[model samples]
Target: MEWRGRRQSSNIEDRRAEGPVGGGFGGSGPGGGFRIPVGSGRGGGLSIGTIIFLVVIYFVFKAMGIDLLQVVSGGQPTPAGYERSAQESSPGEEDTKAFVATVLAETEDTWNGIFKANGETYREPRLVLFRNAIQSACGNASAASGPFYCPADQKVYLDMSFFDELSQRFKASGDFAQAYVVAHEVGHHVQNLLGILPKVNEQRQNMSEAQSNQMSVRTELQADCFAGIWGKYTQQKGLLEQGDLEEALNAATQIGDDTLQRRTQGYVVPESFNHGTSQQRSTWFKRGFDSGQLSACDTFNNPV
Candidate 1:
C-alpha cells in the first residue's frame, strides 16, 4: 500500500508507556468472585471483617445485575502481571504507528463520505494504542485478544504487536493485510453506528449457543464486507498498490474461525464457528470490494 505521507488520525491515544493502570479482584471466570490473596505480613491479606464486607458488596452488586469484578477491573479481569514482551518494540515501531494512524484516517474518510451520502452523520471512533494489556469499556484485554471495537465506549483498542503476530503466526503479512485488521474493527464501529450490533446482540441473548455463534458469524462477515468497501475507496484514491486486494483477502482467509481452529487444534468444529469459514470470509470481502455498496454487504438477510 502507498500510504506514506498520508493524513494520520488525531484520535489515537498512545498508552504504550503507561502499562496496566487499573487493578481489580482476581477471578477464574466471568462470574467468578474476587480472590483476596493470603500472606503472612501486616498488609498481606484482608481481615475477616473486611472480607465479609467485600462479600456483601459483591452480593449487592450481583443483585443489581452489575458485575463488581468487571467494574473494579475496568471491564474484564485479566490475569495478574500481564506485561509487554521484550520483543514487542522493533526499529519500525514508530513507522507502524504512523501506518496505523494513516489507515484509520482513510477509514474515517471512507465512512464519513458514506454516511453523508445517506443523510447521516459519521462519528469517528478513538483508537487506543496500548502495550500488553489495557482496560476498555467492553472489558480488560491483552494483545492476545487482538484488535477489537467496544460498542459500549465506541472506541477501538489495539496492540501494535498483533501485527507482528499477524505476519509471523497467521502468515498474513502485508501493509494492506494490517490495514484490513484496522478497517474490520472500524467496520464494527460503523455497525454500531447503524444499530446493527445492538440489534444482533439483543437477539443473541435469547439464542442458543449455536444460534448465537451463527449470528456472530454473520455480524463478522458483514464487517469484513465493510472493510472491503473501505478498500475500494482507498484504491480509488490511488493508495492501493498491486496485490493489495490479495493481501487483504489472504488475511480474511487466514483469520477465519475454521482455519484458525484447524491450525491450532488439528480439527474444525462447524457448530462452534462464529467468524465463518475461510471461503465465506474472503467471498464476502470480495463481494464488497467488487460492489462498494452497503446493499452488497448485508450478510444478515443474504445467504452468507
Candidate 2:
C-alpha cells in the first residue's frame, strides 16, 4: 500500500502511555468517582473485580442517560499520587501508526464523497489507540477481542499490536491487509450511520440464537463488501501494489468463522457461525471490488 506521504487523520487518540491493561468506567472528569492514575501505584494493571465494579457503575449511569465514558474522556486531571510519564515508540511502531492514520484519512475522503452522492453527510469517527486493554462505551475489552467499533461512542478501538498477531498468528501479513482491517472497522461505522446496526439488533431480539448468528453473518459480510468498496477506490487511484488484493483476500479467508472454528475446535459448526465462511467473505469482498456501486454490496437481499 502506498500510504506514506498521504494525509494523516487528526482523529487518533494515543493512550498507549496511559497504562498496560488500563480500563475504567464511570467518573465525571479525571477524578469524578473513581479516578486512578494508570501505571503509577496500581502496578499498571486492572483487577477483574475493579472492572466489574466499573461496569456496574457504567450501567447505572447509562440508565440515567448520563455518559460516564464521556466524562472520563473529557481530560480530567489524574490522581495526586499517580503521574503519567512519557513513553516512546519504536521506529517500526511509529511507521505503523502513520500508516493507520493515512488509511483512516483515505476512508474519510472516500466515505464523505459516497455519502454526499447519496444525499447524506458523513460524520468522521475517531480511532482510539490503546495497549492491552481499554474501556469503551460498549464495555471493557482486551486486545484478544481484536479491533471493534463502538456505536455508543462512535469511535473505533484498536491495539496496533494486533498487526503482529495478524501476521504471526493469523498468517495474514502485508500493508494492504492491515488497511483492510481498518476499512472493515470503518465499514461498521458506516452501518451505524445508516441505522443498519440498530435495526439488526432489534430484529435479533426476537430471533433464536442460530437465527441471530445468521443475521450476524449477513451483517459481517456486508461490512466485508463495504471494505471492498474502499479497496476499489484505492485501486482506481493506483494506490494498490502488486499482491495487495491477494493479501486482503487471504486475510478475509484466514479470519473467517469456519477457518477459526476449525482451527480451534477441529470442527466447523454452520449454525454457530456468526461471520461468514472463508469462501463467502472473500467472495463478498470481491463482489464489492468488482463493482464499486453501493447497490452491489447489499448482502441482505442477495444470497451469500
**Candidate 1 clashing pairs, residues 3+ apart or interchain:** 76-139, 76-140
User: Candidate 2: which pairs clash?
Assistant: 30-76
Cα lDDT of all candidates, in order? 0.80, 0.79
What lDDT is reached at residue 72 by model 2?
Answer: 72
Model 2 residue 201 distance off true place after TM-score fit, in angstroms: 0.7
Backbone clashes counted, model 1: 2
Candidate 1 vs. true structure, TM-score: 0.78
RMSD of 2: 10.1
Model 2: CA > 4 A from native: 21-86
Q: What's the distance in Å from true for residue 99, model 2?
A: 0.6
The prediction achieving the highest lDDT against the true structure is: 1
Q: Give the TM-score of candidate 2.
A: 0.79
Model 1 deviation from the true structure expressed as Cα RMSD, one decimal place: 10.9
Cα lDDT tens digits, model 2, 17-124, are 776223443222110111100111112667899988988987776677565655676844333333243246677878889999999999998999999999999999
